[model samples]
Target: MQKVVLITGGSKGIGKATGQLLSENGFKVYGTSRNPDTISNHPFKLLPLDVTDPNSIARCIDLLKSETSRLDILINNAGAGITGPIEEIPEAEIKKNFETNFFGPVAMIKSVLPLMRENKSGLIINVTSIAGYMGLPFRGVYSASKGALELITEAISMEVKSFGIDVVNFAPGDVATDIAAGRYHSPLKESSAYKATYGKTLELMDTHVDSGKDPMFIANAIYNIITSKSRKVHYKAGEPLQKFSIVLKRLLPDRWYEKMLMNHYKL
Candidate 1:
């Protein structure tokens, strides 16, 4: 029996690369995009899905159920980034970040759990970020949302482990993607205290992302996770330094860790 896998935000970047790779690995892969019609030259089947909308999520899952009797794996990869100073960012913008990055994946898991539980075996992968561990300087809200996702994945893994459902918090550091294009920027008020600093920080962040590891770095990680027998709760993917720093951050003192980050961003 071929394993059925669904990936959100599969039109581009890590999602696209993962879907393509998973299909090549012989999984019955379905990739979702807000505009499925726009997905071109992809080997995997495209499904229209909007994770922020419950109705859209339900409809897409139902469509999948209609075609396949079971869904073996779910990859919650659909997300966006927001950049700006914490105080200057609007409440609505922060809410939007949580809606897409956190709530969307939560809703996805809830909707699919019954199907997974029925099958007695399944894997759920949530795409979080390294920024989630230690909040980024300017992208505070974005980091917070992914930080929430990291915990969500952890909690769900504990609850579902006995049920034969595997959950992994898949955190990727910098990866080359169109996420910057979709990123939102906080309004820069003329009187904003952090206006100048935010601009420089955001620019440096963009530069780091522009020089990020390839999307294949993440795609290959996902492929390995799905195929492996061992159950790892968290998998970090990216350049070696970025991936290893998760350990370094934990071992370092609070002020020292923060100072390291500040120095990296030239703050």
Candidate 2:
């Protein structure tokens, strides 16, 4: 029997790449997007999903349950980045970021867990980011959302281990994607104090992403994790610099690490 895999935010970038690669590898793949109409036809099925909407999540799972009796893999790849200083960021925006990046995935996991538990085997991959490991200058909100996800994945991993279910938090460093282009830009009226400092950092970050690793690299890493007999609780994907950041966090003290990261970002 062909293994079944479902990926959220699978319409583009790493999610889309994973869908294509897994399909080629013989898994029945289902990719979800907010606008199913815009999704180009592929071998994998495209399902309409909005991570922030509970109704949308329920409907998607219902369709999946009706079609497939068992689900082998669930990839929570839908997320958005909100860039701005936390002090200057509005409460609404912070809540919005957490809703989409953190709560949405949690809801999806809750909906899928019962199905996986019944099947006795499953893998849940949460697509976190390098930001989860440390704070970034202007990306405070994005980092916070990912950091919360990292902790959530850790707790879920421990809780689900006995059920033959595995939860992996996959953290990809800056990948070349339109996500950077789509970053939320706060109005100047709402962010005048830190605008000058944050504007330059955002520009540099954008430039760095323009030449970052291809989304296929992340897809391949995820493929390996899903197929391996032993699953790791955490996975990091990106260039050498990103790996260095993780190492730096481990080797240096908290104060020192903050200094180094700020220097690196020139903040």
Candidate 3:
């Protein structure tokens, strides 16, 4: 039987690329978009899913179970980026970031595990970000949410390894994606004391992204993870620096390491 795969946030970007690549490789691919109708025609399937909605998640998983009998891989790729000074960040937007970036993926993993346990085999990939390693400058809370998801991915990896279910955090640095266009802003960010630096920070966000790696860079990395005999708990996808920055952060003293990051973000 062909391996069955499901990816969230599949309407575009990394999720869509992964779905296409897997489908070409003979996996039965099902991608989820909140607005499936908005997606253009594609070779692989698109399932409507709102990862933040419990009912929506349950419904999608149940539908997958009925159709595929067993799901071989689950890729939690649904995430969002919220930008602003930390203090000025709205409570509701912070919660919204956590809801979409962390909680949604958690729910997906939990809902799919029972079926994976029954099969005694599966791989779960949590698409995190490079910012998760540090409290990112303007995008601090968004970083926090991804950081939480990364830890959750690690914990689940350890807990589920024995069940033949492996979970890995795929932290991709600035990939070229429409996610930039989807960025959310705090209400009072422009009026805050950090206003002078805020514009520059946003410019930096775009700079890194415009120079970022391709979505296929991530798609290929994930493809390799799925096909490997055994996988690491974490894999960074992007330019050499992205994959290595996390290593340097681990190697250097915190003061020095943070200095490097601070310099990069012009903080």
Candidate 4:
């Protein structure tokens, strides 16, 4: 039987690329967007899904179940980005970011587990970020939210192992996508203490995204993980240096790592 796969935030970017690749490879691929109708002529089917809303999540799964009868793989790629100094960002914005990045994926996983348990096999890949491995200046909230999801994947992987289900985190470095258009950015106030440094770092962040790896790079990574016989709990995809940064963090002293990051951002 062909495996049924659902990818959240599937209208564009990495989600779209993964869906297209998987569909071409012979899987039944369904991707979800908040307003899927807005997009037409997509390669794979698009379902309506808003991860921030439990009702939307439930509805999307119900729709998928109605047609496919089974969901073998789920890609929790739905996420929102936020950038600002920790002190300047509003409490509500932080919570909203969590709703999309952390709580949303948790809800999706919960909704799918019952069916997966019944079938006695399933795979879940939570799309995380290289930024999640460490706190970065001006992007702390985004890092924290993705970091929380990474740890949750670890916990879920163990809990569901007995049920023949697998959960893993796929953390990617910067990728070229339209994510910046939707990112929540705290306004740069000229009088604010962090105005100059925050402004510079913000530009640098955008530069990385614009020049980052192609989305297909991540899609290929996901494809490999799905086809692999035995998978690890964590996998990362991106530039060698970006992947190496994680290793460097483990090796470098606390203050030394901090200094290195500061210099990278030209702080």
- The candidate that wins on TM-score is 4
Residue 67's lDDT in candidate 4: 94
Question: Relative to the true structure, how large is the alpha-carbon lDDT of every model?
Answer: 0.90, 0.89, 0.89, 0.95
- Model 1, clash count? 0
Off by over 4 Å in 3: 187-190
RMSD of each: 1.2, 1.5, 1.4, 0.6
Q: Model 2: how far is 12 from its true place, Å?
A: 0.5
Q: What TM-score does structure 4 among the candidates reach?
A: 0.99
Model 3, residue pairs in steric clash: none
Candidate with best lDDT: 4
**Model 1: per-residue Cα lDDT over 137-194, one tens digit each:** 9888988999999998989999999989999999999988877878998866678888
Which has the better TM-score: candidate 2, or candidate 4?
A: 4
lDDT for 123 in candidate 2 is: 95
List residue ranges in candidate 4 displaced over 4 A.
none
Error (Å) of candidate 3 at residue 79 is 0.5
Score candidate 1 by lDDT: 0.90
Off by over 4 Å in 2: 188-191
Write down the worst ten-residue block by lDDT for model 1.
Answer: 187-196
Across 234-263, the per-residue lDDT of candidate 4 in tens digits comes to: 999998999999999999999999999999
Residue pair clashes in candidate 1: none
Candidate 2 lDDT tens digits, 32-60? 98988875666578898998999999999
Model 3 quality (TM-score): 0.96
